[model samples]
Target: MNKIAIIAACFIAPILILVTMGIMYWVNHNTLVKLDVACDSQFAEIDNMLKRRADLLPNLVNTVKGYAKHEKEIFVAVAEARTKIGSAKTVKEKSLASSMMDKALGRLLVVVEKYPDLKANQNFIRLQDELTGTENRIAVARTRYNEAVKKYNTKIRSFIGRLVAGGMGLEKRDFFEIENPEDKEVPKVDFES
Candidate 1:
């Protein structure tokens, strides 16, 4: 009886340890993957909002052009910025393009201020409002994405997570951060005048 018990213990001990380790690894890997999916979804939402804003730009430009024809340079810049933003393929590229578009749009808005007719145009005002709302949505989505990435990165770098990730081929994900964060200051548009 004593010999049989010892034999069973020797056979079961390593197997139990391995099974527990496998469960731990699976749980960690699944959690990380879930977080990554959430991050990707958030980024997609942000991209959609940006695309909405981009779609609105041409109409806004056309409306402004009708009144501020002399500001050809501003109009051209806005159009070019929109084109670049539409063509951006990666998150980093999109961020840089978005910042450029914001600057160009700011300049366009400044030019629009000189034209009272453009300022009061209902279509222009409506499009501006829509763009503003989209920008707010983008900001919220980006915040969520960054938060998800932070959680995922923290997990993958932890002790047990490191082992799990290494065995499961999981890698850290990059946050969709602004390229030139300091340059993101959108010029104040005082349409009150």
Candidate 2:
């Protein structure tokens, strides 16, 4: 009877340890996955707002063009920046492209200042309002994305999470960080020219 009890104890101890380890690994992995998904979803929202802004830009440029026909260079630059936004893939690339768009749009607005009539045009007013709202949405989405990245990075760097992440081949995600200090400022929209 004593021998049988000893054999049973030896078998059950390893099984219990293995179950506990498996559960711990699973819980950690699931948390990491959830955080990763949240980051992706937030990035998608940013992308959507960018596309919305991009779509509005052409109309805004065209409306301004009717008033200032000789301003070909600025229009071309805005178009190029808009193209970059579409072509950008990675988070960093998208951020830089967005900055380019902001700069181009800023230059375009400078041209708008030269013609006060364009400022009061109904179409221009509507497009400007839409772009402004879209920019705000982009800012909100970017903040959310960065927050998600912070949480995810914190988790992966944690003691147990590091082991689980490394074992599962998970990597750290990039935050939607501003590469240029100038890009931190929202493009000013002063229609009072």
Candidate 3:
């Protein structure tokens, strides 16, 4: 009886430790993966919002063109930026394209400000309001994405978490950061009357 009890205890001890470790690893790994997915989804939402803004820009440009045909250069710039945004393939590329479009659109707005008629046009005003709202949403989504990424990255770098991430073949993801010279400068909008 004594020998049997000793044998049982010896076998069960290592098994219990292994089970506990496995459960801990699994829970931690799952949590990190969830965070990563949240980050990715938020970024996708931001991208979609940017695309929506870009889609609206062409119509806005065309409407302004009807009122101000002489501003051909600004119109062409807006068109080119929109095209670049549409063609963007990666997150980084999309960020650059968005920045470019912002600059072009700012220039267009400045030009539009010169013509009081364009500013007062019902369609133009409505589109402008919509675009502003979309931009605000994009900004909020970006903030959320950054927070999720920070949490995920912190977990990935932790000792045991790093081991688990490596075992799962998870790699670090890059944020959609814009560090270009053009992105650094605020879009010049000469609203001077």
Candidate that scores best on lDDT: 2
lDDT of 3 by residue, 60-86 (tens): 988899999999999889889888888
Rank by lDDT (best first): 2, 3, 1
Full-model lDDT for every candidate = 0.84, 0.92, 0.85
Taking all chains together, each candidate's TM-score versus the true structure is 0.89, 0.89, 0.87
What is the alpha-carbon lDDT of model 1 when measured against the actual structure?
A: 0.84
Give the Å shift of residue 143 in candidate 3.
0.9
Q: Which lDDT tens digits does candidate 2 get at residues 1-193?
A: 9999999999999999999999999999999999989989999999999899899999999999999999999999999999999999999999998989988998998899899999999999989998899999999999999999999999999999999999888899998888779877766667795
**Candidate 1 stretches greater than 4 Å from native:** 167-169, 181-193
Off by over 4 Å in 2: 1-7, 184-193
User: Mind sharing the TM-score for model 3?
Assistant: 0.87
Q: Candidate 3: lDDT of 49?
A: 84
lDDT of 2 at 60: 95
lDDT of 1 by residue, 1-193 (tens): 9999999999999999999988987898898778778878887887888888889889989998899778889888888888888888777888888888888988888888799988899999999898888888888888888898788889889999888777778788777777776675564657696
Instruction: List the pairs of residues colliding in candidate 2.
Output: none
lDDT for 92 (candidate 2): 94
Tell me model 3's lDDT, rounded to 2 decimals. 0.85
